[model samples]
Structure formats: C-alpha cells, structure tokens
Target: MSAKYGSGGWATVAIAQSVGATGALIAELGWGVTGPQRVPRLSAVDKSILYRQSVSSRATVVAFAVLPVSVITWLLCDFSRISAIVISLGSLCLAFSPAWFFIGDGKPGQLLAYESLPRLVFVGIAALLIHYDFPIGWYGGALIVGSVTALSLSAICSHLGFFHWKQNWRTIRSQKEVVLGRAISGSFTSFAPALVGLVNPLAVPVFAAVDRLMRMALAILAGIPNRLQSWLGAATGRDRHLRSLMSIRYNCYLGLVSGLIFGLLAPTFVTVLFAGQVSFGYELSALSGFLLFLICTSRGFGLAMVAAGRAKHITISVLCAAGVGVPLLCVLGLYFGAVGALAGQILAETVGIVIQSRILSMKWKSNRQWSTYAASVLQS
Candidate 1:
C-alpha cells in the first residue's frame, strides 16, 4: 500500500533509505567520539543557565525527534525546502547543544565556561530556526550525529576520569573508530528492518517515520552509562555490585519508564505534529506499543554496547539490516500488507537481538538477559 504524502510507496522507500543512510553516518559520532578538541562547541542557548536548569529530558523528548514529524508536516504543510532546512538546522542545533555543568569541584550548579559560551551561540541560531519551523529531516540528523562524536569522547573522558575532555591525535582517531563502530551497529540494525519488512513492508516506513523521534529520545541515555560509571567510581558511589548493577538498573528502569511514557505520548504527539490532526488506529496503536517496546529494549542494549565496547557493533548492524529488510518487506507487503510486514520485522528484530544478546553474553564481561534487563530498569 502507498501513502500519498510523498510519491507513494517507492518514494517513501527512497526517503526512508536516505534517513537510514543519515542515521548510519550520525551513529558514528556517538559510537566514536574520543577526545576533547574533538568535542563539538556548544551554542549560547545550550550554555545558558536557564535552559539547562529548566530543560528536562522528560519534558522535551518530543522536540528532539522532530525529524520524522517535520518530514510529515512538510509533506502535508507544503512548507518550502528553505523552511525545512531551517527547521532541521534548529533541531540539529538542539541535538548538538548541551550545557556542561561542573557538578564537582566548582559550584555544583555552575556551567562549564568552555561548554557554555559556544553552546549558547549555536543554540541561539538553532532556536531562531526552530521558531521559524525549519525542516529538519535532511541535515538535522547530520548535526545530531556530530553531537554523538562528543559523546564518544565523553565515554573515554569519563572512563579515564578526564573531565576536561578535548581533541587530540587520539581523538582524531575516534572519528574513524566511530564510523567503523557505527557500521557494525548499522549492520545489526539491518536485521530488524529486514525481517520487519519481510513480514510487513509498511512496518518499515511506518516505523522509520514514526520511530525516528522515539529512537532519538531513547538514545538520550547514552550519557547515563558514563554517569553511572562516574558515580560508581565516586567515594560513596555506592556498592561495586550495586554500581555494576546500575547498568541493568538504568537500562531497564530508565528505558522502560521512558518507553512507557513514549508508548502513551508518542502517538498523540506524532499524530498532531505530523498528521496535523490527532488520530490513532488499532494497528497504529499496536504498532506504537511495539515501537515503545523496541525503544525500551534499546535501553539495555545501549548499556550493553557501552559495557561491551561500542553500540555500533550491534546497533548499526540491526539498523542496516532493517534498512535492507525494508524493500524485501515491500515485497511481502504485496501479500501481507502492514501486519505481515511488521511480523517480518518483529521476527527479524527478535532473532537479531537474540543473536546480539548471545554475542553480548559471550563478549560482555557481565550479561543481563533481556527480560530481566527490562524488569531491572522498571524497578529502578
């Protein structure tokens, strides 16, 4: 079945594929960032005390994943590419923008000067673009991808206890490492997309468009693992077993909590944002339920990646496989339509996650089963 927003079925596939490619490129940033100079400069708004103090991940989660919604809006709104470009930039700026807090030796409430000054400026530009309703699908992602680059470095910085993370020859190496790592993640991701498509072609695009925001929102926890590690390392950082257990605790609890929130809110949020009207179908509802389930699953998976080495090794693979699976799903859609396509995707993701989980068990220093994983986080 074809939706008329863009060019119908095939065009949807092309756009979806393009998004996949972009996601792959961005995944490299988080999977790879290694040093401080490599760290992206933050904008003024991002640096501001007000924004940092006021903004909560819970409140603004919908705003972050606006790419898919923006695309849908553009299709329906008939907004100019210029508008789209502006919107995308704004989102990208937001995605990249974060104010650094001392949280330590300095004022516990203070902003890191280095991070604040630049973050303020950049996000200022971004905020302007956002108010204008810029289209964010095309490059917004690329911008966020760059943020992950910093995230990568942040990982090493925290592990080494280098609060003053900066770029160096070593971090430069991170660029390549990030891409390579993301490729690994993309390949695994392909499994989910591929199988889903085999079951239901419609599922691929449906999720691609809908899941974009949700996925990004869930990924916010990329910072949490480090936070956990840092805390564990602290004097009273809590018990080693307890600290280690934070891995599962945050993954299962934070993720599932977010997933539950997303499952409930994402539907209405995307509906009004993308469709320009709020509506939901049973299929859409079930799909939405599944979508949140997947995101919740990612919580444990992301921590697993951090624990193992890099998420890209597993995540990139799953996404890339899903990308490949989409077209195959279309063929299946010719027969089974949406549900069948979704079935294909579900099976693929299930199988792939299982395989990846197995790999994680063998490869991981500590392994948490998925069921237990979700439960742990839920308790947290």
Candidate 2:
C-alpha cells in the first residue's frame, strides 16, 4: 500500500488507526487492567451483570464518540475520506464487541471463535481484494463486514442468555472516577504516537508501520505476562505480593530473551515485509521492542496497583509521561522525523515504567512494614 499510494495513503491509514484506537481505548475504560481485579471477587451472576453493563455503557459512549471522530478524520484526510469513514465504522463495531465477556469468563475458546475468527476472515477478504486491485477503501469495508458478523454472533450469544443484562446506571455512575481516569490515561498513552503522525504527516506511514510491527512483537511476547498480571490482580495478601514479584522476575527474563530475538529479526522482517520502504525505522523497531519488553515487565506491578485501587497513582504517572513525552516527540519528529518520533516514544515509556515501578515499590515496602509491625504486636 505504501508502495502504491506512497506516504499519503499510509498517513490516511495511520490516522484512521489512531482514531480507531481512541475508540477502543474509550471502550476499554481500564477494563483490560481492572477487570481481573473485579472478576475474581464477584459471583458468577454478578460477573455476568457487570459484563453486560460494561458492554452497554461503553457501546453507548462509543456510538456518540465515534461520530465526531469520524467526521473530524474525514475532514482531515481528504485524500482518503471514504477509507477513514470505513475504518471508523469498523472501530465502532469493535468497540461494541462482546469479547470481553468471554475474557472475563476465562473462555478463551469462545473469545477466539467470536473475536479472532471474524478478523481472520477479514484478513482473507482484504487480501483477495487487494490482489484484485480493488480500492483501498474496500479493505475498510471488509473490516466492517467481519466486525459486523462478530457483533451479530455476540448478540446471538447474549440472546441465548449467556450474559445477564441489568440496567444499573447508579452502579455505573459510581465508577465514573475509574472509567474517566483510565480513559484519560489511555488517551495520553495514545497521544504521543498520534502526535508524531500529526507532526510529521509525511512520515506517518513509516512511524505507524514501525509502531505496528513493534506492537505485534510485544503482543506475541507479552501474552503470558499479561495473563499473569490478571492472576496477580486476583491474588490476595502475601500471595498477591509473592506472585507480583515472581511475575516481574519471570517476565524480565522472558522479555530479555524475546527482545533479543525481536531485535535480531526486526531488520530482516522489515526488509521482507515492507520491501524496504520503511527500512528507515528498522533500528527503531528493535529499540522499540526492547522498550516494549520493559513495559511488559513492569505491567504486573501496574496491574497490582490497579487491583489495590491505586488508579489515581497510575493516572498521575501516565499524565506525567505524556506531558513530557508529547513535546519531546513533536520536537524530535520535527528535526529527526520518524526516528526521532520513535526515540520520543521510548523516552515516554521509560518514564512511565520508572514512575510506576517506584510507586509500586513504595507501596510494597509500606505494606511489608505494616505487616511486620502487626506481627510484632501480635507476638507481644
């Protein structure tokens, strides 16, 4: 695509992706981080209710949110207006997806069938379309088709009574702090990358492509750590602390090995996959992979904080990173282009990991001290 349409097409896709990611973040609303904290503590019935409410609430917000974003994106990307609209539609479908229900239930099979399969179908269709020299917008349509199918299946599952729906606006309202906090944090987390694209609009494709590749590497390697963090969140007392430390250690080792492998393979991967149009970011990809490793290693502690209801601390940490990272990205991107953007992102993630680790360490030390003090008093 970059070869055919040049940087403009890639920029369009990148912008659409940014808009879509924002929608996903709005839908996520810390659920990815906080769901584990709540799921294990709730009864099965309560979990079902929570899932339905979450889906409904998020869907409602996304419907309203996506419209303005889509319009703004379409206006901004005059070169790819239809493509932007298609991407926004697909994003809206994703926002309303019920895959979270399966995730909360620990039904990986259903999640795969309902979430993964449709996406695979979309990929196949998109490949065929592109092979036949169809319009780029057709790719977006394929995504929407697949997403609609997945959503239809989710609706069927809900109709079959797999989930319980309860209208609890009061309860939903009560979680406003968490939902808004996570939304703000997530927005900032995404802002740096998007800002790079906006700043160096011509380099959008290169930056976005490299970021996507690095993210894929992180996704593949970080899965285990991600699940571990979930389990850590569900653990209690000494068990929680023990598991947290163990998870961090295990992921650090895993991340080192994975980062090494990714860094070694990334140059070759870019050469083959992007046919060298994006070779500029080959080294950046490797660097980003290592940074991703750091982020994944620290994730368990972050989850533990969320589990302990320390969302404010997490939010503050992210805000600080964004405040520093965004301007750095713009400055670097203006001067160094995509590589500078990548550098800025690494700086941001590093700051985030450092702050989060420090906060978690302090919390852990405080807890240990209190535990020892209580034990001494009991002994006396």
What would the per-residue lDDT of candidate 2 be over residues 1-380, giving only the tens digit for each residue? Answer: 66656567767766776777666666655566666556666776677667767666666666677677777677657576887777656655566555545555556677678767888888688767766776677767777787667666765664422333356455457556666655655443444445766666776767777677766777666557556645765688888778877877887788778777777777777666665566653477677677667766656557667755575588767776776667778889878887788677678767877887888888888988998999999999
- Assess the local accuracy of residue 94 in candidate 1 as a C-alpha lDDT between 0 and 100: 39
**Deviation from native of the Cα of residue 113 in model 2, angstroms:** 1.2
Question: What TM value does model 1 have?
Answer: 0.49
Estimate candidate 1's RMSD in Å.
11.8
Worst 10 residues of 2 by lDDT: 159-168
TM-score of each: 0.49, 0.88
- Candidate 1, residue 133: lDDT: 55
Cα distance off (Å), candidate 2, residue 292: 1.8
- What would the C-alpha RMSD of candidate 2 be, to one decimal place? 2.8
